[model samples]
Target: MRFALVGTGLMAQEHIRNLALMPGNIVAALVDPEPASLAWARRSLAESFGPATAEIPDFADVPSMLAAVEADAVIVASPNFTHHDVLLLLLATDLHILCEKPLCATIADAEDVVARSGGRRGIFWVGMEYRFMPPVTRFIEDVHAGQVGTLHRLALHEHRFPFLPKVGDWNRFNRNTGGTMVEKCCHFFDLMRAIVRAEPVSVFCSGAADVNHRDERYDGQVPDIIDNSFTIVDFDNGVRAMLDLCMFAEGSEEQESLVAIGDRAKLEVGIPSGIKTLSPRVPLGAPKAVTREHVAVGDDVLAAGHHHGATYFQLRAFLDAAEGRAPVQVAARDGLIAVAMGAAAEISAREKRVVGMREIRA
Candidate 1:
């Protein structure tokens, strides 16, 4: 499949690498407003794919690229704020889309896209690649298989270094990236919804910009994004999920830890490393037998980079869906809900109150 990839930043580089590895997929066009990013993309593509890269075209913007390129699909990896416009333009064409998460910076924009996109012929796939992460996929499968019977609670924790600087530092502000939760935690939110198989009804969040990027100024503007947050989500199905995020922690064996508790069993999984554990049947009596099992993901998906090897599988699924061989695993509604969760969490944290998901939904 020929693809016009929007944005040539770090994430785009990963997509470029993965696209190159695919047998018939080719990046036909690169789109970005910044000359430096476009130039970097050209060099990176040339370095990665050698002389064949010359056949690919680079554009200063999406509209011009869309006009010039004939592609089977477009991958929208542009900044969060630009997703709405970029996607609207691409939706006019007959190309499938694999859009990055947080479909739009705001729920209003998301609603606009959803409304305008009604009955569109293209396969609009949201890029919630965490759903394809090997360990995460396995964990969800196990939960659905009744390994963790009747899940009641889930906790997802992330302890990592501060946000990595983006191509233009656009991610440092909520206006551009839709807050830290939307920018970073959307993956976890999407995961929570997927694993629990329920819609979040309300969120209570506590967050502060206590560290990371506070002392730094970009274009004379101090970053306002919160570096840490704890969010509690109440799902419609009576499942509860909590997210704990810390951007100041250092030297961790794993970047994320997830625990799911059910009526009959409990499950724990660590990110990147893909170490998983399951404890079946807590002792109700002193003589009751209980068992614990540890499972390690055998594949080294992380070696390929980008979300611990899930990108490849995600792209493959997109390709399969586009080819009519499979259904889209991550739908546009999934992306909207993830964004709503984040936006509501941001509001809840800022206002020191619980925010309903309906408050963000247009």
Candidate 2:
């Protein structure tokens, strides 16, 4: 399968690298507004992939780029705000799209994308790499197989160490980038939906901008979106979920962990790692010392590098799904759900009240 990477950013470079590793995928073309960045990416990709079958060409825009490149798929790795425009142009083609998370900037665009691309020949795969992790996959399997019995409640805490980009900075501020909810924590929300096996009923959120929003980090012009947020989601099937996202956690390695309690067994899936079973041995009056077993993932996702091995897994899965070898792990439908939750969280924060998912219209 041929791929036209829409943006030449860091994520795009990671996609190119993963594509190079895949058997039947190639970076046919590169697209970006910045000429210098595009040129650099093309040269870097060519060198990394060895002598390419065709010359690498860069395009300034998507329409012109698609017109010139004979690619079967396009990886829309552009900024979060530009997703709507980029996907709008590419959805017309038969080309499959692997868009980065938070499908679009708003719920309206996400709904529109879903409606427009409903019966199309190509598939829209969101780059929610966390879903592709082995632990997450196993957890989903266990839940489906009745291993965990009836699900009750789950809690997720996603903490990211401060590592915002300095150049062309919209990521640090939430105004243009859609804040931490859309820009960063969409992965956890998507995972919650997947594990819970139910749609979100209502959501209530509370947040503050206590991290990296100082005068030194703020560019003076950008608005301060909350860097820390806590959200509670009520699921349809009587399952309650709590999600906490923090961008200012010190001494944390962008850590994310999920604890799902069920009637049979409690599950714990550590990000960048595999599943661990926590036996239900309630502590006694004397404080019971409880310890059973812990199993780590065999795959060296961390050693594979780049955002805890998600970039590689997500890229490979997108290619595999396109080639009819495997299913798309994080489909556009999942993307829409995630974006809906994020959008609802934003609304809940603004209104200072519970926001129903059904009320969150396009």
Candidate 3:
């Protein structure tokens, strides 16, 4: 299938590299208003695939690309604020759309997309790379397969460096990127929902822009995005999930740590480490039955993109869905709920109160 990328930014460049690994998909046209980003993408495509890929058509915007080129699918890696409008045009056509996470920068816009995209011929998938991570994928599978029998609690931690610089520093502002919770943590929120297999009921988050971006100023305005926070989500199935996020901890070895505790045993996994540990219940005086193993991903796959080659895995599944071989794993509704959960976390952080999922939906 041929693919057209709407925004030629860092994420789009990652998609280009991952597509090179796939070998079946062709990037027909690249679209971006920023000349620098477009030029960078051309170089990246050539470097990722070959010199021939640099000859792909380029356009300043989606409409111009749509008018000049034909593509089987389109991936929206544009800025957070532009997703709604870009999707509005793409959804009108029959193009299979793979929209990057945080569906929209606002709940209202996400709701509109969910409402409008009731039934479409082409596939509509929300890009969620976390669920496709190999070690995390194995962890989730073990948890679901009764390794962590009767699961009740889950803890997810992401201690990593601050957000990378975007094209125009758009990520520093909440108004443009839907706050840190929605913009960045939406991936975690979606992961929680997928693993818990239930809708979120309430969220209580304590967060602040306490560390990063303190001295940085864009037009004399300090960045309001969160650098550290703790968000607790209460799922309808009585499962309690917590997210511990620290954007200022670049020295941390593992960027992500996930733990699931249940009645029979406990499961733990760490990203980049790619190690999964399982400890079954043991009597007070019995020997520990802890087991450790690694889920290996090829070096070539790992080199494709970040998230431990998740983009490549996700793209393969997405193409399968596009070709009528499987259902859309992450639908618009899932993306909307994930956005709502993130919004709830943001509101809870600012208001110093628990925000109900119903409140956001209502």
Candidate 4:
């Protein structure tokens, strides 16, 4: 399948690398506004893929690329704030799309994109790659297989260093990247939605720009994005999720940890490692069972360079769905919900109150 890639930044580079790994899939066109970035992408592609990359075309804008290229689909890896406009433009072409997370910067934009993309022939897949990670996928499977029956609560915690500097530092501002929660936590939010198997009804969040990137200034403007946040999401089916994020905590043994507690069992999955399970005994005075399972994610996936080997799987799944070889896994609604959850969390934190999903949707 022929594809057109939007943006030529770091994320786009990762997508390009994965695209190179896919058989018969070619990047027909590259779209970027900056000439220097486009040239750099061309050089980078040639360096990475050798002579075959020479045949790829470059365009300054999406319209020209859409008008000239005969691509089977488009991969939208552009900036977060530009997602709405880029997606709307791409949807008009009736080609399948694989967009990066936080589908849009705000709820209204997400709603608009979701509305417009509906009933279209193209498959709209979002880059919520965490769901495809080997360990994560296995954990979810175990949950559905009754290992964890009727999940009551789930907590996703991230203790990592401050945000990496982007190509343009657009991520440091809320107006550009839709705040830190939407920009960084959408992956976890999407996973929470899938694990709980329900819609998020309300959210209560508390966060602040306590540290990291505070002393930095761009164009005389200090970064306004929060460095730490604690969010609580109440699902409609009585399942609750909590997200604890601390960007200032660096050099942690595990970058992320997820814990799910249900009536049947309690499971803990450590990022970049394996899963641990503990189940209560049914009979009175019976001993509980403990188990630990390690996961081998494969070196090929690791080389793909995003989300610990999930990006390759995500792209492969997207290509298969686009070609009608497989069902679409992550729909536009899923992406919208993730973005909405982030937006609602931001609102909740700002207002110091519980924000209902209805308010976000409205």
Misplaced by over 4 Å in model 1 are: 284-301
* Candidate 2 off by > 4 Å: 51-54, 217-219, 273-275, 281-305
lDDT by residue for model 3 (1-362), tens? 99999999999989999998886788999989999999999998889878998679999888888889989999999998999999998998889999999899999999999987767888999997799998988988998998999999999999999999999999999999999999999999999988888889999999999989899999999999988999999999999999999999999999999999999999999989999999999999999999999999989989878879799889999999999998889999999988999999999999999999887886
TM-score of 4: 0.95
Better of 2 and 4 by TM-score: 4
Q: Best by lDDT, which number?
A: 3
What are the candidates' C-alpha RMSDs? 1.9, 2.8, 0.8, 1.7
Pairs in steric clash, model 1: none
Report lDDT (CA) for all predictions: 0.85, 0.76, 0.92, 0.86
- Model 3 poorest 10 in a row by lDDT: 113-122
Give every collision pair in model 4.
none
Candidates 1 and 3: which is better by TM-score?
Answer: 3
Residue 138 displacement (Å), model 1? 0.2
Better of 3 and 4 by TM-score: 3
Q: Candidate 1 overall Cα lDDT vs. reference?
A: 0.85
> What TM-score against the true fold does each predicted structure earn?
0.95, 0.90, 0.99, 0.95
Model 4 ranges off by over 4 Å? 276-288
Candidate 3 clash pair list: none
